[model samples]
Target: MKKIIILTLSFLLICFLFMQFFRPKIVNSPASADFQAPPNVKAIMIRACYDCHSNATSLRWYDQIVPVYWQVAADIKHGRESLNFSDWQKMAPADQKSKLWEIVYQISAGAMPLGSYTEVHQNAKITRDELSTLKAYVNSMAAVALPDDTAKINAADRQYSQWRKEQFLIKQVPIAPNGVRYMPDYKNWQAISTSARFDNGTMRVIFGNNIAAAAVRTHHIQPWPDGTVFAKVAWDEVEDKDGNVKTGAFKQVEFMIKDKEKYAATEGWGYARFKTPKMIPYGKNALFTTECINCHRPQKNEDFVFTQPIKH
Candidate 1:
């Protein structure tokens, strides 16, 4: 028995030692084109996102060890594929704009600076001021004076509005006189994106209609053009025996309907929530509009929507 135990320990040590030799090569490559940002904005990004998303990764002692190094390597690999700030200018103008939008959306949704990464580097968690700075930087990119190609987003808004009104007349679902309704044909609509909110105990799938789809495809995210409508359905998440989580019970469904002329009282968008199949509207006398805007205030620049276009 003693000899067998000694052999087992020796094998384990050998395996650990072998893993060190196979560690991923951590390289600090030169930036293809140095991405420029305001001093404060650059500082925040460096502290929060650089390790995973840039070539200038600074790994800690444990980050160089075997199993942990494996995870770090994979994260950096996937992160660069998503968006490499080091190669920012190498991307086309349209791609740069799209990437900027994604950065703002992810940060606003509390999806970036990954939770696991922030667990150890607590300072990496974004504070409100830093988040605002990052968002402002992204918004500034959108405001830059580009050629007619990127500048046409404004003209496209009017065209989309006329198109949306036509669709609304033909296909808009109705609610009862008491403001109750059932879920509409959202599954058939264009899927905008999906999101999970660990802080809220829910996962959501967002859908957009023809008008919203056109606007998103055109990259006209702000001011949201009239007649745009969105449907977001959320569900409780349940963990299976394998520790994988899946959508459990139906939690709720919400809608954001945009009509600049008619819904001008609520920032040109009307909000509604249905907590059950009965589809009773959420909230009491003034609570709905007030609460909806308050919750979405952080994403005001994205036209009060948290979901961004899913880049295929």
Candidate 2:
């Protein structure tokens, strides 16, 4: 009996040790500049989809466990196989547009991130309003199909790429009062005040970043007039109570005119909300208030996006 008890304890110890060796590869892809998503869409995708779909996964401590590690790896593999935002440039224009549309459908149909995913990640659950907004955005993208001819699309892409390269070379003026600085790499950060204006049946405002612009453009919204509204976005790193470095990535600020013809008037701007995969599945909306909006209120005059311009 003594020998049997000893063997049992030894087996349990071996199992525990073996489990530690089965650590899963964590997803930690760098954010790519080549592909940009809209502020709102980007926020949602980062919180929910990035874990599996992109290289920017924010791994949690539990992900290091053995069985759980296997599950995470499998999910990430499947997610990336289905769609990878990091590789958006590699896809044809049509494919990119189509995939954006599919994202909306999947989210609306409650098929995204998988129910199993949400069971563990309460934040991944989509609210009705969020779903509606996403649907509208996706539909707008689908409405504007690239020219049917494949060669024409390729030609357009080449032209766009050249234009972007040229834009990158242009000298940038520095603007401040919002913590922007010039880097040797030609990226100019600016701190700009923001406001909103609606005029002639159109909403117009100045914004920073092509991703935000493309997100707005894809939705078929008219651009705000130049200088009508200005904003700046930045991230600050700080340590948590536990002395862990906490990063506030994807911070944003925006300003917009609430009524028509009053571009100078400031509407409320707040931090855009984002959630992690773990929080997304639990159907929690309050997380937005805590994790996102509170910090953004300081720049309420802007429409809740940090409106700093980057040189290409």
Candidate 3:
């Protein structure tokens, strides 16, 4: 029995040694650009995010070991594809801001510095103070040029009235670039949640179709059953001097249709957006769904959904 055990241990050791030679090449490059931020914010991001997110990855000795190395290599590759702070110089100004905001969202959601990563890199754990620093930095850039003039606000009000009038007219429904048709009946569905975007001066109401509504009521929402569908409609938020706020012009409506088998590539949800009263569809082609999927990645644990339904 002792001899057999020895042999088994020796075989396992040999296999582990051999696996090291088959490791995926870890590509480390000098960062072409460094993310610009205050010293505190920069330090936090470097400690928590640089491992898989930046080109200058400081891997530990244990990370260089066999099977684990393969996962780290793959993670770095996918992470860079999602957002590479090292290549920040290559991104457009608007894109840089968008990615920074996304970083804030992902971090706040506890979806970043992945659980697998933080398990090994204990120093990557973010503290509450660090989170506040990051949030404050991002909020400082939120100077949204909303419709400030009374003329423009009145025009938006007029547009809202015209939009309501158009609901009665039977017309050809617009289809998105990805083939999702405009779901007009969503207006009558159960509104499950509301989101206010102060940055854009817009308010969004999320409505769930019958299947989705049923899922919410039954608490079957962790993965949310396959047939579930949600519609999020956005409109400008008009505010009076008295601090009262109301909806202005209709801006856009987005949908998330679930089908694990069908939308397997897009995290089990088909996304579509229709903008303006004209109902002009968003996206240039089917591939535009990637943008939606990438934005939803941080909510992967919640089945790529950002909203928590208001229980019936």
Candidate 4:
């Protein structure tokens, strides 16, 4: 018995000693000034995603154990390869948009952080509101160009034309005392509005800007031909640090455009808005719909929209 006990103790001691040498490479990336995260989004990511997907990992003391160390390293490496938060900005604009949408789909489906992960890290489990907030942010980031479906486009165009004509009538009518000017084109009239129209017959309208006249003139004023479709591409304004209001900047919002429905499982559009000085290839008003759809099929009910309805 004494001999057996001695051997057992010796084996345990040897295993512990060997574990000391099993050090996994730490995951961390240098922080950049441009990489800003909304406070809530930042919190959830740190608690759940940073361990695998980011350079900012918070390894536990037990992870130093030999066999565990191997698992930890493997998980980190796989996480980074699948989706590395550290290298997000390095990807093309379209790629960035698609990934953002995918993140939402995974979280909503409860597939993120992996079940094995949440088992050890209890806090990694996402709450209902956190999921909703994440969905909202992802949706905002993915706001993109209008769909290309002919039927939907025609309907949207008719609505836009009616809205424009109503605005014209409002402009012609006089206002009474205490009655504010009901400028139907108030959104377009805003300095940083989405009034720019592309030659392909699409209208870009910002949340608050007036460019209806400009869009009409540029697109050439005429009623839509039968079967002609019109889709509305829209966005909110981006704000600065000092609380100064800036226009034409991309603010994340839920994007449920016609093309998303038409394309269904095939594809979805993704969009993001940054500051004018950022010098992004697409400029402040750039749209990237083609690249967004490939990943959005992961969630079909929401019409490729990432904002999953929080099940009570």
Question: Candidate 3 on 143-211: residue-level lDDT in tens?
Answer: 644435677678777777766556524367989887888888888789988866644567889999999
Tens digit of lDDT per residue, candidate 2, span 211-263?
34543445422333333323322222323345443222222222222223332
Please provide, for model 1 over 1-312, each residue's C-alpha lDDT reduced to its tens digit, 9 standing for 90 to 100. Answer: 999999999999999999889877768799877567789988888889999889999998978889889999988987876667898889887666666666766786777777788998898899998888876776666532223332343434443353334332323354532243434666578888887653334568898888899998787767787878899988655554455555555556788888886777777777777664335557765446776775565466667777767546
Candidate 4 segments whose C-alpha is farther than 4 A from its true place: 27-29, 33-35, 144-312
Ranking by lDDT: 3, 1, 4, 2
Residue 172 of model 2, lDDT score: 51
Question: How many residue pairs collide in each prediction?
Answer: 0, 39, 0, 20
Better of 2 and 3 by TM-score: 3
Report lDDT per candidate: 0.71, 0.48, 0.83, 0.51
- Against the correct fold, how does model 2 do in TM-score? 0.42
Candidate achieving higher TM-score, 2 or 4: 4
Model 4 C-alpha lDDT per residue in residues 143-189, reported as the tens digit of each score: 45433445544544554465445422222433212221122333344
Using lDDT as the measure, name the better of candidate 2 and candidate 4.
4
| RMSD score of candidate 2 (Å) | 21.7
lDDT of 4 at 32: 51
